[model samples]
Target chain A: MTDVPPPASESQEIWRRRRGRNRALILVLAALAALFFAISIVKLAQHPDLFTISLDGPNPSAVQKAPAKP
Target chain B: MNTSFAETTVAGGGEQSPPSHSVAFANETELADWIALLKPRVMSLVVFTGLIGVLVAPGAINPVLAFTAVLCIAVGAGACGAINMWYDRDIDALMRRTRNRPIPAGRMPPGPALGFGITLAAASVLLMFIATNAVAAGVLALSIGFYVFVYTMWLKRRTPQNIVIGGAAGAFPAVIGWAAVTGSVAPLPLVLFAIVFFWTPAHFWSLALYANSDYAAAGVPMLPVVAGAKETRRQIMLYALILVPVSLVPWAMGFSGPVYGAAAAVLGAGFLVSTWRVLRDRQDAAGSSLTNDAPARAAFRYSIAYLFILFAALAVDRLVG
Candidate 1:
């Protein structure tokens, strides 16, 4: 009989492990995003102008104030 | 479920497929390869510059948020490093300096590396957006994209000016850091970005001078590989000459105090002297010295320290003032 060929893709173990790792990574990221969301909420409560998400325009927080007249 | 059975099944059924030879991290060195994928050494510089960026900005940040900002920058830098490693694996395998890297050495798979990179990149940017503001997150995302798409995929293999254009990716940290605090860009961070943009060639070319064969073997068209040693050396000095003065712009503009000014001037002169030595030393190409790269190696080491000291000086000046 001819020699058996190898698997083309990653083995089941590798895929399983990779999936597990990916899950863990996703979880950690989700937790971090959650923490950040909590922080943003707190920050927005305390400093509303500073912690904002924006699209299509400059963040209101970033606008530099003009110098006052002497 | 068994290993032998799985292997047998694959071998028996998968006639058209290549062998699935994936292995676990069998040792600490192999585990370290995963970390190496992150380019920790380079990440250190990114972290340092990013930290200084956050610190020296005029506005104050919540300590937790500041920590998060720095962590995001570090992870973001590592993410880019991983993506870079993943993309450059082919050339990395060819180069002596990178031949032993995880993907090239068969210690880690490319697919996972790519996943790791993209995930960290997305996570970092998202976290930055949530913890800080959109401006910082946007800049971080741009930096990662530029490094991956613009530098690694586009410029690196095609042209000698790759690093010059790719240098903008490295320069983004200062802006990211500053934006994390102020939630906006400013002149000081822009100048900081310029300093890094100019400094990159001098730093990388010195390493390339010593590692010329690696780049040449890999077909990477680095400045030293494409331009020849003399031209590369001249360019190194030219960039250093410009970098020194540009480094002082923060002080000149009054964003930083005199202490930083003095430190920048002194450190810059030293940087110039180091590059001058690199310019004068022909042996970097000749392989004549005991190290076979005395001048280039010295300059490469000094460049790292120079950046650290320069940014540290900036932070100190800000604190002292």
Candidate 2:
């Protein structure tokens, strides 16, 4: 069978240009994962002081003023 | 969706439909693109400001509810961001500064973006209803609608006033956080809203000034495109001037103590001085040097810190006072 012609449109051409960026994203993400887990493991093993979401609970001092009439 | 862009085919040789392609992508990056679509940087700022609102509200909120409120705000901000990325995909493709983003890069299709944004928008609102009061949830939903429909669809391409008005979406998290605790709005939150509202043009215009060429190349009508550099710098100065006193309003209204007021004064003075330095000099004697090299770059970066520090100071003052 004869090879089918590729589709031709401005949108398709633009889409083709984006393929490079997708590959770049993949490479970047792979590098990030290796770096991230390594750092995570090292930090957790060496220093347990790294992570805390929030220290104190709600602030105790915010005075409740009466709501203004709507 | 065709809604992704303000597309106009210019003097086309033939009428056409989108071409069929066999496969969209070859990797997991395409699937993970949805996360980038969330605009993580913007979400962080939304979370910070919303937390400040929870902290400054006259009524104290439980820590768990406050955390939930902040998370919902971030989600709502991210939802709008997804739709923004979707709608601006065409311009994002055209502009070099935006060219690397997921939608512009074509890793994720536009249909998925619209779906993801709307889904998150709905989920955030629902979660808000569960975690906080109905008023807070309603405000969160309205913020999403405003960002998607008003800012992205209607205003962005249509007018330069887009950011000025559309910055309301960013301001709503403060109201959402405040309402989560108190179930209503107040002067303090409104002051916070105005601070962000005014801050938008100044902060973004500095960017537009520096990136005027990218905006011009993309054919987007930013202030620098429409009004020219002289007018843009003048407007930046005016906004910073207005922000100085307005930033100090928290103290005047009694929500902030003297520490916040002092911080605002010093910070405001620094902003104005740096902006003046930017206004006075140029890269050369050519036509309006739009280059933001050192002092201007400092101003732009410090502007972000200025805001976060202001909000954080409010939190600190509350804790100490």
Candidate 3:
């Protein structure tokens, strides 16, 4: 079946609503991102050791020196 | 119900049938319609009480996390409202007060509204868990489930005691807020829950008394519609009487200071007077108001203000005491 185009007034109304919906979605996403960021900062502050990562390997001296290889 | 939104085009004017699965219909809804689905007015009360719960709880929470907890409560409450609107669209269409909701008015399809609600509900619970504790998140999820399942789907249409039982869903925010900080429920938060629980029937029945016709038209068995206006008025008074003492429980239990006790007493007295006026409003033997249900309307308005002020007093007392 062939498609029929909507009338001008109806098309304009549809565009208006679509634009509004798009804007609202953008605002909501931005707000959620900001909220998540704030929550992360607060949680990290409350428990600084929550994500502790030791950059240094185990003390080489503390480990017995392996004999020069086999 | 089976109409595909993608297949349907918008006609010039009038309400359209809801689409089954798509949202590409001509009457793409505006942002305001989506906001309307959230029921922001109801969210305001939930947020206020939840905030008070946080403030009055006996512990310290980071301000950011506290705000997040309240935000989650508000969003969760709004999610329930959106789902309720979706489920009740049929009855909403019949009721004068709700005929203009987005789904019933045909500005938006039901699919998107339901999706929006479920998405928000899940997100709120997840966010609450992330920002607060497991207990807070669990209570938040329970509140959403109680509202969507127990109240909206089950009890709303089946019984006149719907408000009485369903009010527990609304009472959860205070407990949720307390849990967010303390990570557990306390006697104080439970008392606050009781206060809101008892306060709800009087608050809603006052509105139902005046809007009896709308409920009757919609075939929703609100108390006034099922039990007659006279019985509803007496029930309203009974709840009001119970609510006054319940509201004072925090002070009586030594959880609050004298400021709260005094405010609760004064507010409870005012509430009783308001309900008493409603009980004695000019009505025939059948309890239908001859004077346009003005006293019920007044009582309805007073109930909202009463809760706001009473909670504010509690918060203030906690802070100052």
Candidate 4:
């Protein structure tokens, strides 16, 4: 395949990937991130309501899913 | 030089026309170039794995933050890929696989690309911090540092396993995405991380199977170049063997449904079969299925699909059930 030109800026992808290093990091940073300012924008997008995970239902009973391909 | 693929292509009459001068007049980068910049293909896989981490984790964040977090992760991934392209533009111009990239193709200057990458990196990290937390932001900073410094600057020029060690940069988004929602790391996320981490060797070496010519032409020390096809195939198969079970960790841990487990099983086995083809056959004389009959290309393509599908299933299980 021929090489494609890069239209987007490079640094942004790096910034996005780096945030995953730690778990506590996500929470502490998010609470402080002031992304709430972006709440208006976030609310406008798809699947905005984040459910607090609490499992209290019947067992999933291990239903082997198929492998993923994109 | 390991000119096998390119050599064979030429032998098989895969005619080489000179670089099309017409492209100069065309001026504007085609759609593929911009797609290359967003690193959309990479973004798809990285985003999928990150989604897995986000979904399988036990806690949750505000939906807004979560979306913002995933968005940041995708942006950050694209940013890193762009900078990598920018930094490697010189060598990129030499290899067949990358010779047509915007920077290398002379569609854009390296300086502007570098500027663009740096700006995106800074913006994404800042956004991560502002939208999420310091930890995630810091991780963002460090991920860029590692990719730019460790992988791009240090390891790539220095070793063949550059892709192996450097693979860490690609795997971080999942944890970042998970943390964005849950606000903390846990066993499940680590398991997810491990799956991607281990899968890297098997996934990349197959591409190297066919791309070794470009690598050799560029003097890059890819595994197929350094170790030869036989050894590389062995390594691919070995990694695939290990990755299959590792890929199943989420299902084994009860985080996903049986559907996910089934998918992982089938795909993992398919990965093994493809790698095994590379390992068992030597039809390219030294090369195998990956290099010759174009199965390696298929494996390379499937590997991308495999990672995406695997992670997507995890997200579906979490969200749907």
Candidate 5:
């Protein structure tokens, strides 16, 4: 049997709805991303020293000296 | 092509009936239906109260965080609304006020709405935790649970006091907001919660008074439907009287300045007068409204403005004081 395509009007209507749903999804995701990014920036700004990392030296208490001469 | 031709169309060599017109229309409104499920009107009040909570709290929150907290509260309240719609879809179809909702109108199925509510509920709580603190997130979660379990499932169908007890769910947003900033519930937020709690029965029952037939048709056991209009009016008056004192608690406790105190006094008096008119509205011997519930409708409208102006005054007092 040969395949039969949907009528043009029906196909267009379906596509319209799909497009709307997709557009809504995209907008929501973009908003969420922006919100998260803004939140991160604000949180980091609030406690700048808390998240800061010092590359100057390892903590002496946290470091293990090479086990003597093994 | 017409609906019949569309329905009988062959696709991929198989005889397939396309979706009906209503189904197609539902598909077209899919996004809008999802939003409608959130009950945006209710979310606005929740967001406003939550925002006030954040503003009035003791400590400073980054504006971004504050915004996030309010967004989470709004989303969480919306989630509750969606779930409430899902559970109440049966009765909703019976009531004129709710018959046109997405679910009852058959624009959306129940499963997706339930899923949407659950997903949003989880997301709001998790985001609240990340953006604010555990206390705020926990209260948000509790509010969701209470609305879904206690109010929607348990009390709403069972008792005339449904809104009375269920009102606590709506009261949570201010507490959640305060918790977001202070990392704890304080006296001010608690007072705000009490004010909203006491204010709810008067506000809701006023609406219920006019919507009595709708509630009766739906068998929801609302105050007017169960205890009759006279009792409902009395309850509305009692609650309004109690709300006046409760609203003044913020000023009495020194959490707010004289501006809020004066505003509360004036607003509370207006509220009392509104309820008094409702109580004395022209009615038949059976206690039904003789003039089509005009006073109740007016009271309902004034109650909304009362809360808005009252809270706005509190925020202004805090800002200026």
Candidate 6:
């Protein structure tokens, strides 16, 4: 087959690749977010008071929630 | 340095002009432009200060949560920077200092930058809420909103007092960091907030002193542009005077020990000396408008170092106490 010249304007192709890169960035960020949530869940399970930490007054659950000594 | 995104060709039925450049990355430089949109240098300060907030608080914070909090704060700050760049593209192009920014340079489109910023902002808030508490999450959201709406969109263009009031947004990280740990605000973090709030004017004004021409060209209403250099210098000295004493409140309140107190005293003295030099710096012995901004430049660099050291002392005091 005879050689065919590419489109005169490469701007379209450049933007398409950029959009693709953006999509990849979004996916990577989403995966990181998912991992963050997973780790958060695990920490919350290990220490129930992790998120409910209060500085104002004594926390009853905090004493109980403290990890047991080996 | 094109000011108009409204530039359009008459041929396409008066339709919007095609983007001058593609947003796609054909090289590492193009990718770097996207990173530049986030203002990583500013983001680093956010991360450092936010991490210190979490570290020095008198409570236990999970490593994972602390990481999440700092990450969210950094991302949120970056989001605001991106949005600021997008909104200020017109003026940014007009200014010598900012003309090379991604959107202004036409390396990236405004629409994409806005979308990237909003998405990061939403994700950051959601992550903070999920990983931390409502108070921290709410503060994070407010900081982002204040930076984007109150600072960038509203105050920046309207008033010479813009950076003064707008500085509060940068101060939120201390509270957010403390809130992440305590899940509530406290006097000490408020004091930290005050330190940053006061530091902003001196820090920004010094840069504006040197960059006055750029702000004037862009019609940005910066203090140096509207109020004259004399007033700007006076205000910088006044702020430095206020910041030094205010920074000592944590030590006086007994939260921090002598180490912090001594460090604050020394750093505060250095800060005063820097600003005083800026104030006294005038026409040379031969009587010329002080062409070299040595004092202002020294003050500007010292201001950054002063903040970092002050926080470091706070952290050290927490350990040593």
Estimate TM-scores for all models.
Answer: 0.79, 0.76, 0.91, 0.73, 0.90, 0.83
Candidate 2 ranges with C-alpha deviation above 4 Å: A1-70, B1-31, B283-287, B290-293
Q: Please state how well chain A of candidate 2 matches the true chain A, as a TM-score.
A: 0.45
Interface RMSD for all numbered candidates: 6.1, 9.4, 4.5, 12.9, 4.5, 7.1
Off by over 4 Å in 3: A58-70, B1-27
- Give a tens-digit lDDT track for model 1, residues A1-70: 3444336443454555566667766987797777767686668787766766688787866888789999
Range of the 10 consecutive residues with the lowest summed lDDT in candidate 5 chain A: A1-10
Error of 1 at B187 (Å): 0.2
- All candidates' lDDT scores? 0.82, 0.76, 0.88, 0.71, 0.88, 0.84
Residues B158-251, candidate 6: write the lDDT tens digits. Answer: 9999999999999999889999989999999999999999999999999998889899998999998898888888999999999999999999
Candidate 6 regions with alpha-carbon error over 4 angstroms: A1-27, A30-34, A47-70, B1-29, B284-289
Put down candidate 2 lDDT per residue, B187-273, tens digits, no spaces. Answer: 988899999988888888777877888988877888878887767778878888899999999998887899898888898898888
Query: Sorted by DockQ, highest first, which candidate order results?
Result: 5, 3, 6, 1, 4, 2
Compose the digit string of candidate 3's lDDT tens values, residues B293-316.
Answer: 899999999999999999999999
Please, what are the lDDT tens digits per residue for candidate 3 over residues A1-70?
3355555776677788788889888998998899889988887888766555555965454557778976
Can you tell me the CAPRI class of model 3? Answer: acceptable
Q: Higher DockQ: candidate 5 or 6? A: 5
For model 6, chain A alone compared with the true chain A gives a TM-score of: 0.61
CAPRI grade of model 4: incorrect
Q: How well is each residue in B1-321 modelled by candidate 1, as lDDT tens digits? A: 113222223223323333224223211123356679899989999999999999999977888788888989999999999999888877877778887777666556577788989989998999899888999999999999999999999998999999999999999998999999999999999999999999999999898887888899988898877878778888999999999999999999888999899999999989988999887785534433344667888999999999999999999999889
Q: Across residues B174-206, which tens digit of lDDT does each residue of candidate 5 receive?
A: 999999999999889989999999999999999
